[model samples]
Target: MASATRAGHRWLKWVGFLCVLCAIAFAVVWYARNANGNEPALNTVAVSRGDIQNLVSATGVLEPSNYVDVGAQVSGQLELIHVRVGQPVSTGDLLAEIDPTVYVAKVDATRAQLKNQQAQLADRKAQLRLAEIQFQRQQNLWREDATTRESLQTSEASLASARAQLAMLEAQIEQTSSTLRAEEANLGYARIYAPMDGTVVSIEARQGQTLNASQTAPLLMRIANLSTMRVRAQVSEADVGKLQAGMRVYFTTLGDAEHKLYGELQYIEPTPEVTNNVVLYNALFTVDNQEGRLLPQMTAQVFFIQEEALDVLRVPVSAVARNQVKVLDAKGQPQIRAIETGISNRVYVEVRSGLNEGDQVVLANRDPRAGQGESRAAFRGMLR
Candidate 1:
């Protein structure tokens, strides 16, 4: 009975050992399958014709190409606003009106003062004429010995004084006339008119609001020509040197992949803006926005084209190692080929002088013996 029990116990131990081995084999097989699936099999690829472009990317903002701020030239109470935000206006169209009561009163007072000065000037002229006549008569009487020399001298002094008084009155009248003209201009300024044909984009002053334009012209509203848009792109200093005026550039709005707005680089600002220890420069360009789809302050993704090749033979960058590519010859044998490359954007490279199209380029060695060895090594690593 003890010998039979020992045999059964040994049999049960073998079964348990076999189960453990099966579990380990299952896990190893699963791990090997997953490892193969996770990695890319860049074994070989055919040289194909495609488009390649080297571009410099930057972020930008959209704004109206032509915009103006309409401000109050004369300070007064804003009595009426004829235009609202987003309203279309023409040149010379009434935009807003300030209280014209004070300006009108000033103009009337200046006119009255100017008229009074003018009357005084006329009276002075009459008095001068009379004095001249008296002086002439006195000179004749003195020459004839009919009047005293003292009387002739007094007449001459009166004539001189009258001329001086007339001259002073004329100057005062000229000054008053100038004041009248200024007051008239101020009164006209109370009625604000659009300087250009555009749409009113903003309003800073509301009706019945008091505006003080003593130091600076108070902004009443803003007008913009939305038919055209300007783009201001901020490019890093490192990339700014690569750009130039008249370079072909394009941009798109966020999530707008269908439309591409193209324009030539117009200018690059000389001053650099430093932010977060990084220097950036602004690049400006304009595009037609007649449809009014582009708005002010919209963010854009800008791309400046540096180089481009269309319908050219290209290959993945990984396929070429050490400036040499492994190509499969007619005999199905791997051979090293020298290749001349062109513009590249890090993903694909333009093939300038390379093997013919449809030529198979080897990315990785796929020899059966080598593959078996690699698989064995990967399996052992997983087990460890």
Candidate 2:
């Protein structure tokens, strides 16, 4: 009976100890859950005053503002090329010369023909003068009854025929003079002259090359005014509507990306080019290149500034979700608030209202301690 009583006492003591442990475990789990639940889980950024710009980007090529293809007007062997590639030329400066031998020969032949016509005209005029003198003398003789009326009529006929012959020769001479002028002009075409002041950008015709101008004018060289450059930007069809003439724009070459060349949007081509079924429209803008740094056919990264806000309260674009922001209030509590935004680029957004400078906006929820600690606490509570 004594052993039974002691065994019952020991079992009761063990049960009481287990009950105390259970209470301690429950208290720890409750504290963990309550403490971690009160903590915020988020990363934040401050809204600050800065400049923001909305820009459209596209790739383009640099082209001369004014350029021309110099070609040969007459067919002959290209004998001399006076200007080389990259040489600067002035107006009326000799650019090249085709073989003038054929053209010169044609001019000489025309001149000879004109001279022959003029000589024939001079002879016809002399004969006309003689016919007039004879007609007058025969009339005097007929009045004195010293010559027959038939002789007088013959003199008059001779005079009229001589005048007609002289008129015909004069007409022939005038026609030959015109032909001579045309042949001389063709001879001048043999010597190519610079039509404008520019730099020679290309030379297509080589010395000793034969040119055929019968069908089309054979290109000899290319001249361009490099003082100004036009950027031909290929903008996507989606962004074409936002662009217009005189819009603010700038560009940078691949070689010098840090330095930008500024200009206004000058034109947008009405036609769109389709490549691989992707439509693209061309936009042009001009930039002054008085220093001659810009060149033809250079690749440019163009930026069209659509809208800009200066010294405005802005936040990272990622912080705003659907025009709503999660921000930490003055009491350090997270609150969801609607915000009014103006212009935005890919990286930042301009906050027009509902957010102040130095305010903290949440980007994401990130709490390392809450994840593991809360999970363990929940598991412990389940066990209890």
lDDT top scorer: 2
lDDT of 1 by residue, 18-132 (tens): 8768867886786687568544343789999998988999999998899899999899899999988899899999999999999999998998888888888889989999999
**Candidate 1, lDDT over the whole model:** 0.89
* lDDT, candidate 2, 202-279, per-residue tens: 998899999999999999999999998889999999999999898899889989989978899989999999999999
TM-score of each: 0.80, 0.79
Clashes of each: 0, 0
Q: Candidate 1: which stretches are off by over 4 Å?
A: 1-46, 322-337, 355-371, 374-384
Scored by TM-score, the top model is 1
Model 2 clash tally, residue pairs = 0
Residue 185 of model 2, lDDT score: 87
